[model samples]
Target: MSGGLVALLDDIATLAKVTASSIDDVAANAVKASSKAVGVVIDDTAVTPQYVSGLSPSRELPIIGKIARGSLINKLFIILPIALLLTWLAPHFLPFLLVVGGAYLCFEGGEKVLEKLGWLPGHHEDHEEAGATSAEELEKSIVSSATRTDLILSAEIMLVSMAGLSNEHGVMRVAVLIGVAFFMTFFVYGLVALLVKADDVGLRLARGALEPEDNRPGPVDNIGRTIVRVMPHVFSVIGVVGTVAMLWVGGHLVIANLAEVGVPVFHHVLEAAEHAVSGAGGFVTWLVETLLSGVFGVILGAVIAWLVVGASALVRRVRARA
Candidate 1:
């Protein structure tokens, strides 16, 4: 009986070790997979703040929290199941899915570009145009809009990450995919919370530096003042970066997946650029690819945008005539 107990104890220890190792591997894979979707994540972070742009300061963080919660629920409940189903039942069709998602990113990014250029009228309904009649309704609209946007970006994040995990063991793939989803939600929203509240934080710090008798500024005071002034520029920079990232990632996805689906024209150009920049090292090659992808994304996106706008105008004209 004693020997049998000892053997069981030894077996338990071995199982424990195996479990620990598997958990570590899952974590490592999750990080790697999450990294694959960094561009989309950046786009998400950049785009999210716009939803709360004109809202009351006190309400911003809560609205962001609601959106974050919605994002997580959508990912865990809806996206995960559909993604798993597709991965299991129709793995071969994922490239087309990527192309669709990619084109969406392009359309969104390109629309913003055209609006900024004043070439397209603003179709996106802002706070006033949304027809929110009260505080509660307005809050709901903001949350709804932000969450809706997050759904697409979140889907891109999961699907793009999944592309890297296709060959992983089924169990491990599920674990890593789930892990990436959770990590990304928290990470992106956390950064957003910090960004939206940064000015408030700066104000608090500036207030603390109010020495009635001695108005001499301390280092913290200077830092606080600087933060207050810098955040606007930061937001502007983030917006531009996010737009470019969407274009580059979208273009890269479309062109890369096109190769997988037998249309390699764009990929061939990208590869040639990489080859040309080979001697300059990995960073240079990546830069060339990104710039080229951004240009391609913008062009493709503009064409799609024109078609969409023309169609909408035609529909409106037909309705008016009727």
Candidate 2:
């Protein structure tokens, strides 16, 4: 009886050690897979702030919270199950779906560019003015639009993350994916909440909310004022970065997946470009690749935009006739 009890205890110890090792492996794999999806992650971070840009300051964080919650649902309830099912049942279809998602990014990015260039019908300034007609309605609208966009972006993030662990154990893959999804939603939304409220924070500090009222002109005031002055410029920069990131990510996704599907022309062109610039260092090579990708994305996006816009217009006319 004593010998049997000793063996049982030893077996339990070994099982605990194995479980710990598996957890560590899942953590390491999750980090590695997340790095692979950095492009979409950055795009997600950059694109999110625009939804809350014109809203009232008080509602910004609440709006971000709602979007973040929706993002969690998207990743966990929607994308995860579908991705795992597809991986099990039809793994080969992922690249095609990625292409579709990439085209969406391109279309969004391209539409922004066209709108900015005055090629599209609406004036953004005017639109913003009209869009704010009702704060509640605007909040709901922004949240809805942002959530819809998050669905596509979240899909890409999960797919890219899973692609990194394609050869891993099934349990490990699912564990890592869940970790990445939760980490991304928290990090992206946390950063966005910060960015959206930066000006408010700066304003409070500029007024010396923490300092004694007698300290009329402290160094903190200067810091806060500078932040206030710089925030608009920062927002403008974020807008440009977000739009370009969308195009670059979208374009790269399409190009990379096309190559994966055996249509390697675009990928080969990018590779040749990289080779031509081999002596210029990795940064230069990357810049060249990005520019090419953006160009391709713009072209593809423009075509999609025309089709989408024209189809909408036609639908409107048909409705009007009825």
Candidate 3:
């Protein structure tokens, strides 16, 4: 009996060690994968706020919450299993899917640019249009739009995570993919919630400072007001940054994908430029490559958008006559 008990104890200790190692592996891989997807994450953060832009203060948080929930569902319930299957069954298909995702990012970025430049109609005019709607309707609209956007961003994130995983057992792959899905959904939506509520927080602080008890104008009030005043500009900056991020990330993905598929011209050009600059010109080289990539992405995006838009219009005309 004593000998048997000793053997069991030793077995339990070995199992514990195995479990601990598995946990560590999952964490390390999740972190690495999340970092690889940072560009897409930045664009996700930048793009999300626009969905809540026209919403009233009271509806903002709730709408963000709804979208966050949807994003969670998307990652865990939808994207994870699909990602694992693709990784296991059809790894070669990933680059093609990523290229499709890149095209989508380009299309979205190009559309935003066209809207800002007054070339696209239906630019969101919040005060006039959204003001007429009920708060509940507005919230639903915002949440739906946000969730749709999240689906695409979530797809990109999943693909990045899938690419980062080692060719391990199916169970290990599933564990890492699910772990990353949860981490990214929480990270992205939590940040979005904070950003959406920042203006309200500023307003509350301003009101508190302006209370009659304080009497004289205080620095707090001034700062609060300043935040309120600058919030729109902040959102504008985020919009521009998001568009630029989309283009940059999309272009980078395309370049990387092309290199993966055996075309190395762009990669070689970038490397030669980096070498020519040597130590002193590193930053300049990076900037030039990034700018060129962005320009290429934008041109490709615009052409695609034009084709899509024109095709849709023709279809609509045919339908109308029919």
Candidate 4:
């Protein structure tokens, strides 16, 4: 009886240890997965403020809050189940979906690049000036528009985050995804709220406008002026950063997955480039890899964009003739 009790106790202890280890693995995997999707997260953060921009100050938080809730619904309820189902039913299709997502990201990034160069028409900025004649009208417009955008961006985020977790057990995979979904929605929207309010915070710190109180700049007062002065530039930088991140992440995803799917020319070339740069140390090698990926991404994106544009034009002509 004593030996049986000891064995039972040992089994219980072993079970406890396994449970603890599994929890830690889930957390570590969650963080790693989230890191992989940082590009989408950054773009999502940058894009969200436009929904609240130039709106009534009082309506901003409520608008952001509702959009955030919609985003959570998108990730937790909509995207999560669909992703799990795919993983279960047709695990083989994930790389293709990721390639599609990556291409979308690259095309978006390339659009920004081409738009900046005056080579492409932009429908993106036109979204901001849409009519919002009343608070209710504004809320509906912002919520619906932002949530729709969030769904696309959130889908990319969840899938990209889970891409590296294919080898994990099913329960671990689900837990990591759930953790990532919650954390990312919160992080993206939370930062967006802070960003939109940055100007307001700065103004209060300035104690007035961009200038300090009574022409005397205290540390806090100077900070206020700095933030107000810097916000426009900050927004511009964020747009650039988001674009670059998209290109890098998208390009890397495409290259890596192509290798996975038995087309490894680009991947081998990238590896060779990295090997060439290895003597410069780790950071330089990483930079070279990222730049090459971005370049490849832009080229692929431009080709896709051209095909899409051509197809659209052909369809329009056919419709007109019909």
What range of 10 consecutive residues in model 1 has the weakest lDDT sum? Answer: 122-131
Candidate 2, residues 1-322, lDDT tens digits: the string is 9999999999999999999998898888888988876667777887788777766788889999999999999999999999899878998998887788788878978887887887776523221445557877777777887899899889888987877786885778889999988888998999888877888888888986445757575788878888889988887887778788778878998999899888999999999999999999989999999999999999899889878889999999999999
Which residue pairs does candidate 4 place in steric collision? none
Off by over 4 Å in 1: 128-131, 214-218
How far is 10's C-alpha from truth in model 2 (Å)? 5.3
lDDT of 1 at 321: 100
lDDT of 4 at 39: 84
Q: Which digits, one per residue and each the tens of the lDDT, describe model 4 over residues 101-182?
A: 9999998888889878878776654443358666687678779988999999999999899897878877888999998988
Q: Rate the local accuracy (lDDT) of all candidates.
A: 0.88, 0.85, 0.78, 0.88
The alpha-carbon RMSD values of the candidates against the true structure, listed in the order shown, are: 2.0, 3.7, 3.5, 3.2
Clashing pairs in 2: none
Model 3, span 1-322: residue lDDT tens: 9999999999999999999999999988887888777767887887777777755677777777788899988888888767667766987777777777777778878877776777766445343345437766666666676787788889888886676674656777778878888889889889878878888888887888875875875789888788888888877777778788788877777777777777778778767766777677768878877887788678878888778889989999999999
Better of 1 and 2 by lDDT: 1
User: lDDT score, residue 205, model 3?
Assistant: 77
Query: Could you tally the backbone clashes for each prediction?
Result: 0, 0, 0, 0
Predict model 4's lDDT versus the native.
0.88
lDDT of 3: 0.78
For candidate 4, give the lDDT of residue 99.
Answer: 88
Q: How much lDDT does candidate 1 score?
A: 0.88
